[model samples]
Target: MLDLQWFFLLLVHQLIQFSSFSMGMRYLRRRTKILLMGRFLYLFLLVIMMSFSTSGQSKSAIANFQKAKEAFKQNDTDKGWVHLEKAIKKGGNTYYQPLIFAGDRRFKEGDILQAIEYYDRALQIQELSSIHLKKSIVYKYAGEFDLAIDSYQLYMKNARMSKERFRASELALENLKFTKRKYEEYMALGAPLEVVKLVFSDEKMEYFPSPTGDDRKLLFTARMVQDGAPTDENLFVAERSGAGWESRSKPVLGRVNTRLNEGASSISADGEYMVFTACNRPDGVGSCDLYYSYFDPVKGWGFPELLPGNINTKRWESQPTLGPDGTTLYFVRGSHSQADDLDIMVAYKDDEGIWSRVEKLPSEVNSSGRERSPFIHFDGTTLYFVSERSPSIGGSDFFMARRLSDSTWSEPENLGFPLNSFGDEFSLVVNAAGTHGYLSSNRGKDIVPEQDAMAEMDLYEFALPEKMKPEQRLFKDFVVVHSATRIPLGLANVKLKGLDEKEVYTGTSSKNTGLVRAMHDGSTALRVSAYKKGYLPYSAIVSKVELADNSTLYELPLTPLKSADSFVLRNLLFDTDKSELLAASEQELRLLKKLLLDNPSLNATIIGHTDNQGGRSYNQKLSEDRATAVLQWLIDSGIESGRLKAQGEGMDKPVATNDTEEGRALNRRTEVRLR
Candidate 1:
């Protein structure tokens, strides 16, 4: 230190002595210029001498710095740190280089306190604007949030007005605030989260669970290794036991698991079918495409076939999630060239039992960043998925939205805090009862002790927070049958319309089983209908209380299309105490129009009946007017006016006792009689 100081003092001394030579020759201009050149030469000599003295003092620092570099190259981080500290102590404090390097190394190693100390020491030596960002990050890691925020403010303030560093400084501060808000909000609402590790699935790293509507089983993705070869992703199943899953010896599910990759499956709510992803198959239209398989009564699961329609392209499609009723499917859709631009897509099954063309969800849910692992809850309204968009918890995080209508969805809400962290959390699903949620994460070691310490990805179930829960759901099953013969009918198109919101769900009864299942919220009243070829359409308005019994099976009994056959139109709606048809009757009216179009030679009489609430004469006229409305609609829909006749029963014949509201609702009906 003294030698360096002596070097600087010597330079000042030579400068002063050379100025005297220049002053004495000032009277003669040429002599003065010569003396000035001599004075410059003397100053250069002094600078060269100082350089030698400083270099001699810095030799030990340079040697230690080289040692630190070699240690770091060899990956001996601890040894590198030791050498770095020694170098700084040996007069290496001439610049902020070594100090900042040490700070970054410690920060990357997760040594928060040491990183903070090094950054603080470096900032004192030279107040570099970039050092403030390093300091801010270390403070954030230490949970000193207030200090971290202050550091970010200083960093941004010291940054240049127009430069690359300023943008990073600005974004860093914004992200810090967003992360703090998300974390604090989670803490404020957070409770005791009990995450259950499904060790039953721990054998080969099972993930992306898709629970059946009854929560009776969990279908997940795993690996299938060939003879001494690399593994291919495949589907597996785990049956639900008393309170947990049954640890099976080998639960490889179905013929879907082939030598090629097939994974990320979704089971229908009725457990009658599944949709999964397969890649590079002979028939595939993309790198990965969604495949469909049906449940067989004799065999466990039938062979998988490529999903019908334009659902696949040159892009990749994976991670399918079927809606509870099995009518709609949601999945991940990504481009072959841009992986980060993945979006969540959907498709609906039509009356013909083929999936419609795939449509990506709107930008409201699919942000500019990647969207993945969509899981539609059994409630049939809420959708949970993963997004790497803004306000994320570093990596990907779980976000949820609800179906506002068939075409629109609500704003996405982050599942928040302990449920999401610094790493990726994906493929989140809620149980049938909405009591628990399941997901896949590599955070098993930190979240639970019993889980394997090095578990890369493990299945876990956590009780869903109250705000995070979807609506309580129940399974609604039914069969379409003949009214007189009581014989089951297949290929019936059944639709359930929620009375509260007019939200409709559609499904086709199985061709062989004659079984139909739809998800119900257990609260909203429903207008359920069934239609089939060569049969009269059947519809009934079911009250909310009737929808409570999950085990109850309802029936849609259709009368065969023949001369003189009549069936009740229970879903027909009219204005109170009037005959004008309400807008609510449009759906039922469309079905009647289709019926007339299908049978051109058929002639029918539209008869309106009333409950036992009004006078006979008044009821007769009102009923007659209501019946005429249907006839007029048929005529307007291109049915010949002479082919339809209107009549009124006027409460003369009661179908039920009418003592209770249910029986009265049954008695009030508009019926179509084939003539």
Candidate 2:
């Protein structure tokens, strides 16, 4: 006999050759023979058609798989899925490669069922370590802890080549056992899985909606590590609405997001400015430096400038809190003299409008131990911060302190209870409403999947007990600043006035931003006047603030007061006998006319005053006429009547003593108040 293999091949070749020959012979005959041959030829053609069609379908299926791979690699996940579906429909058995890649892309993008479907297809083809790992991650995200653990174990069995991979496998194994135990305990404690979401995921560590108390904006820090390589931590902000946070979380770009690490940002109440820390740079005072920037509603962020030398030094200055008033800056200062210890420092603006050198907060607030993350409440009286120095249930507990009557700080009080655990808590912010806020912690249950053995930091919002509502109150910020010199001014009295010019509140600037934010309740447009001994008082009005107001920055550009200037009283009290002044008084109102003409949009009210000598009714009438005379002069001087108002106080209201003649002369005056 011929060799067995050669004999089998020879048989296959003879079958095909005979089939072809018989097909040719059938086509050649005529009449009955031709008809039979035509039938045979038709059968032969049918076989070829079937074979070619099957081969074309297989090729198309393979092409689709290749296309899916290309699409996935290019990060076009949606298109990749479409191509993958096409490949699956072609009824071919060679689509495992593309399916596996698609599964990975979907898993990374947070898609679960679709990823499992593709992963299942890949497993059907062959057992792959990478595919098992992918399945494990999906299982974790799906909350199937047990299955995810098994998948991870299987992956480890085959992928023990690299030390890093081995370490990762071991860690996963340990975490799986730990998680199983914790799950049992949680169930035993009557806790639900939904509540467990308060924990963080190891894969994504940054917690949003920072505890900063302002709901209009959210501040958070995210470490931008790529492929396990160190990258600068970045600070990001998101605008919050009742509808929820908007898309495109805005990054505090530019100097705030420097090549060096810059994160842990806090925005003042009005959201006009922010301060954050940057570290490991040549410009840094110690290992880190605190820098600040202001946000203009119109022009955007001013360049990041270093804090005054008084606040920054050879020591590390970081974790800055731009107080609600923008006047006081509270921060953690790590002293070079103390080496590793950190103390909280407070700085304020002095009377000359300069920041005082950093002064250590009273011992009640700082200690030899580290105290950081000082958040001044919007009310401008309460301060919340993290301190390891205080007694606590954890490594670091949050504390609150009240600004005492004498301007010293109260003894710090721990925030207490379920809000504190054996784990450390950091990064807290509360909204003006006070019922809700956020804090970062790792003390809760593990959130990482069995496949991820890494520890995670979680963000949680806990409500204070009902009886503690008063203690849980929150504050907002209100900053008053100069239109020029972004620096904050000290000792500048900021008087917050209501629409009626009644004093509502008062405050002074802090060291960080030349601003003073005060506290008030109710709805009213506010007029803020910043006054110095000699400099012209700066006045501005803030109107139409929605409810739950905080730091509202009102910038004032002051004009200096002078001695030589004398203002004319066009609409003075009436002539010698009459209580009314005549229209001819317009001549004396020339200066007033020019002033109103120069500022067409300017609005002012002319108040007429008279000496105490005339009859009460007659003086009232005379003062009224004098005021009307000024108003008429303004209208004639091209000032819009809509922009002018005349009011007569008569002799009833006198600025100086009305008894003495000199005092009477001063009392008989006309004054203009601009709105």
Candidate 3:
């Protein structure tokens, strides 16, 4: 119809020019000819003014329209739509191109009815074959289902005579069909489709979500371009408000973000201290070390310091997760022994904020396969972790274990089906309420089809099964340490003995510190042994009497034997001044039996000494005979002969004045050692 209008307007232009020429010749009177010619000129000027006025509006609208397009490209969609609206109001239809784009932007932004009004305005001025197809899109998105079908039918009718037109119309019809299907899907879901706005997005990398107790402050990881070059991922934070997250998503700079990668941060429940992982730092012992930044009320995050040698060794230690109570710390460390992957380990903090010895999680929780990202719930007994070792559908899956009434951990249960898939899930944290949790995954359940592969992770909330939500025992301190060093020990031999030193529950500390956690709600007596090279074994009887809510810090000390420490030989007997083996020394050899049994590592040379009163040669032979007699006694007592060396330091070596009987007694002696 608009084409017919343009054709008629062209004919009117020719008539106007012809009429002016005819009128000018016929009129002889100058005033009359001038008046007739003036009327034709007036008409022509009016037409030119209309044409130029339309073109001016076209230029203005096109300029604003271009700005709107630029705004959309900048991801400022809201501002883009505002400018596009202004372009339409300024009569962009004065130029056909502005009219088409204005309608397109409006339709794509989901303003279907507004788009149809603009498209209708365009069609009224020009009947380009393209306008009919846009009409179909407007009707489809506007939920005018029957109108959409009718518009598409008309498009088919118009296209039947032209193959090119038919193909274009068919494509539009197919798009309308897909839109109708999506519209049904959008309506069927009972809840309103809340738009998942990209609060923070980058083409680089992102992970870790450490939110405070109030959920107002969120700390996460983001890898963004720095200094015109791609850089390692670092911690970035944003705050939440009623209007949604604030912009820029600034990095947590200075100490926390170094030249190396740093992430997996955990804030204390009180929000006072934050522990995170910084790999390959200058002071690190291995590939990664757990460093802590204290949150002072006056100053913010302080300088990060590497944890002490008791925990971090020449091995990788990372993923430090502080329990909500802020005392029990959980982390993952690669196995030092022959193991395939890393395991979850834990450490305990003291009143002075010093960490306990690091120990691995129990075998029930940590298997031979890789287990990482351990998060203890607010309840403390419920430990949630990501594991690829378990029978997951694929990759890694979230599994949880509940504490039992007997204090043992219940068999782990997989968080099944829809919550987990064949992709990797990590950085899991359950809320203080224990009902909701968050994790990161690449699965796209809500994204558009074309961008599904690029779908980024967002926070998800899930419920705990009622059976898995048991009350947990609060741990004030599980202080297990070495007896000698007065230090918290790792990998010590701990057994629950039945009042009589019988073995019961036994395991080593986790990798975080030497403090291994086991359910002790019902145990009677705890027997612990701290073992190390060159130290006497020490055992303690921790009476589980008058049990209190908070446990006490028990320390054990071990004593070691030196080479000068001597033993008595009761079985060695001889005639006056004679050196020979006698049955009497057998009783004294039993004492050596006890020492060997107590200290399995003790190997020594049994040397016999003599007083200065005897001749040197005779004393040497007599001393040798005495040493041989004692060695034979030790052998008879079942001591390994290979462990005993016999040597006589005759009259040459005397300890005291030797003039006194007590000094001579001391001078004639035997010694043993850890050889």
Tens digits of per-residue lDDT, candidate 1, 1-675, equal 567567666766666565555554445676666567766766776666656655864677778878998999899978987888888787445545678888877776677888888888888878988899778767765657678899989888887767786675576677678777876776676465677778575546567888887788888887533462437787788887798778762555457777798889888776777888889999999899989887766666778899887677789989998876556888888886435478998987764567876688998898988989899887778999988877765467889999898789999988766777555675688887898888886654432222232235668888888888898767677888888987878767777887664544676676556677777766678988888879888888877777776576788788778778887777789877988887778768877877787888889899998888878999888889999999998888789998999999988878898798978877788999887
TM-score to true structure, per model: 0.73, 0.47, 0.40
70-146 in candidate 2: lDDT tens per residue?
98778787888788778766735544666776677666666788888889888887778888888876786566778
* Candidate 3 backbone clash number: 20
Instruction: Indicate the residue-level lDDT of 128 in model 2.
Output: 83
lDDT (tens digit, per residue) of candidate 3 on 190-297: 553232323554454456677665455667766655564557868877676674567547776446787788888886543445788887778887777788775543
lDDT of model 2 at position 412: 86
TM-score, ranked from best to worst: 1, 2, 3
Worst lDDT window (10 residues) for model 3?
446-455
C-alpha lDDT (0 to 100) for residue 214 of candidate 2: 46
User: Worst ten-residue run, lDDT, model 2?
Assistant: 446-455
Question: Evaluated with lDDT, which candidate comes out highest?
Answer: 1
